[model samples]
Target: MVLRSTRLRLHVGVSRVHRWLALIIGVQLLLWFASGLIMSVLPIDRVRGERLVERVSPATLDQARPRAPLDLVLREANKPAREVRYRLLLGREVAEVELADGAVVLQDAETGKRIPPLNAAMARAVAVQAYRGVAPTPSIRAILTASTEYRAILPAWRVDFPDRDATRIYVAQNSGRIVAVRNGTWRLYDFFWGLHIMDWKNHEDFNTPWLIGFAAGGLALAIAGSALLYFRWPRKRRRNK
Candidate 1:
């Protein structure tokens, strides 16, 4: 009789513990489920703005243009260039030279003059090349400072398209590299991603204190539930028999 009483007490204790833990961890579990479902359904390419923006083909250098001698251009620079390559910049053939200090310079192959950095018009033209015929006139906004989207790459250009998704592409000023591409779908995905990871600040870290606590609570709840089942199921079967 004492053993039976002890078993009943243990069963009630585990049941109460399971109920309390379920109340605590159930909401987070639902959030995890919802966020995961949303992420799984959305197409990744559309979220990345890949469908909205096309890659610009490398501009071909005109072989017919009479270029300045490499030896003369090097002498004009008065320093040994680490690397030199001929490429078309803003429809002009130029020698892209990397100096010892990792600085990139563009020297006009025809006149042997130092080509200036791309201006607004030049930047616009470069951005226009990165799209299909649908958005020939995307609003190009220049951001010299770091922004939320173009955080690391500063002095970049934001090329905004008027597509249904409102796609935006980031282009670097110095290298003209397409740094990032994002859209409305990407923003929605990012929102749920933050919730899923439990990191609202950086939206990347998953080892937060809140998540750890919830995980521990959930684990405890699962164990308690299993214990309750183990104690209750046999008793119900025996009562039926």
Candidate 2:
């Protein structure tokens, strides 16, 4: 009698726990399924806005311009530069130097003179070089703060192109690098990504405590459901027999 009573208690306890777990984790399970489906349906390149971007061969710096002597530019800067390279910025030969102190300086290669921080015109020119879109000539939309699509590179320029995708390119002023390419497709992917990872703030981390706990609860619920099926099926078979 005691053994039977203990078995009954164990079965009830497992059933209750399984039911509660299902209640807690069911919503997240549905989200996982829906998010996964959306992600799988979209091609990765389109999701990343790569398909909208036209690949262009970068113009060689040393091809036609008579670049200033590298040693002279470094000496003129009067800083211990960690790296130096001659590049054409806005059709003008310039020396891009990165100092050991983490400062990036641009010098006119012809005159070996320091160029000022990029003005609106210069930013527009730099942005134009990086953009290859089927639109009217792209223009500077805004000097971005630490907001919008480019959270990674703050104080970047937002270059707007009149393309069908409403393409916007983020160019970093200091690094002179094309920081991010964004469009409608990427925004949708990012939305689903936030739902999938459950990390809305950064939109990247997947191993948060809440996600882990819900996943564990969902897994336990599935196992318990299987166990319940196993136990109930045999009883039904025995009764039929």
Candidate 3:
């Protein structure tokens, strides 16, 4: 009788815990499901704004053209070169020199003249060339620091288009390259992703304390519910023959 009473009390306690856990963890589970569904339904390419970008063949270096020697270019840069790349910037062949201190300098591949940094007008031109969207005019601004929307490269140009997608293209000022493209769809997807991971601030970390705690609670809830089912299931009585 004592054993029966103790067992009954334990069962009641477990049921209470299960209900509390359900109440606590249920909302997050629903959010996870909804976010997952939304992410799955959204096409990855559109999310990345890939369709809006115009594909262009990379400029090839002409070996036949007369060019300044790489040694001369490095000497003029004055800084120790960590890495050097020859590429065509706009229409001119330029030597992109990455200095030992991580600063990038552009030099004319033919004359070895130091190419000036990209101004707003030059940045706007680069954005226009990279974008295939029908937006007539785009407002341009220089982003000197990293932000949530544009973080890949520093000292970039943000060109905002007045289109349905509210497209924003980030062009690296020094490199004259399209670093990142962001639009309205991406923002929506990012919002839900932040919720799913429980990292509202960064939207990157998946292993948060809140998530861990909820996961533990969910596991406990499942175990407790299973125990209740086992204990409460009906059993057939033996024949009284």
lDDT of 3: 0.86
Each model's lDDT comes to: 0.77, 0.75, 0.86
Candidate 2: regions farther than 4 A off: 1-5, 54-56, 63-65, 137-139, 233-241
Clashes of each: 0, 0, 0
Clashing pairs in 2: none
Q: List candidate 3 stretches off by more than 4 Å.
A: 1-6, 55-57, 232-241
Find the 10 residues in a row with the least total lDDT in model 3: 50-59
Model 2, range 29-90, lDDT digits (tens) per residue?
Answer: 89989988998888887766666553333677666657678888998889999998777676
Error of 2 at 94 (Å): 2.8
The prediction achieving the highest lDDT against the true structure is 3
TM-score of each: 0.74, 0.80, 0.87
lDDT score for residue 36 of model 2: 86
* Pairs with backbone N, CA or C atoms under 3 Å apart (clashes), candidate 1: none
Q: Which residue pairs clash in candidate 3?
A: none
Q: Sort the candidates on TM-score, descending order.
A: 3, 2, 1
Candidates sorted by lDDT, best first? 3, 1, 2
**Model 1 lDDT per residue over 107-137, tens place:** 7887777776656667767666776537547
**Better-scoring candidate (lDDT), 1 or 3:** 3
